[model samples]
Target: MVKEGLLDILKGNFLVSDEASKNWRFLLFASVLAALMIASSHQADKKVHHIADLTQQVKTLKSTQVKHKREIQQLLLESRLKEELAPIGLGVPEQPPAKIQIVSQP
Candidate 1:
């Protein structure tokens, strides 16, 4: 009888047997785990793409920052400032600057 039952199970006839009813909960749990694994994999892929996009944005912003900083440094040079001021008739004085000390009344 036991050999006949084992043969029945091996022949894909276990679902019609009493053991299938007893293992319904295990089957349900396995299905849920499989669904969760699929969801987790999709979420991981989304995060990877998001990180790549952010990394590219950072690189673009860094290059822009470097370019702006170079432009600002070039504009702030003494020769550049003098040239710009000359157009406004504001050239630096040739005479040495004098300092005046104030004396307070006693």
Candidate 2:
């Protein structure tokens, strides 16, 4: 009997047998689970790729920020300021600034 059952399974006859109706619900549930697992796997892959792309963008933005910071620091130097202002005839004062004292009459 066991050999016959195994033979029937191997020959795919069990799928058409009367007992097959009893397993339809379980088969449908398993198929749904398999499809959900595939969809979840694809969603996970998309998130991973998105994270990688964002990481690359962050690296690029960081490098650009560093470049701009360096340029700003260079421009803030007194020598660079003097060079930039030379064309406009602006220069450091040669004499000290004077402060005037006012006397209040009582």
Model 1 lowest lDDT segment of ten: 14-23
**Which candidate ranks first by lDDT, i.e. highest?**
2
Q: What digit string (tens of lDDT, one per residue) describes model 1 on residues 32-69?
A: 99999999999999999999999999999999999999
Model 2 gets an lDDT of 0.93
Using TM-score, give the best candidate's number: 2
Candidate 1 structure lDDT: 0.91
Q: Which runs in model 2 stand beyond 4 Å of their true positions?
A: 1-3, 99-106
Off by over 4 Å in 1: 1-11
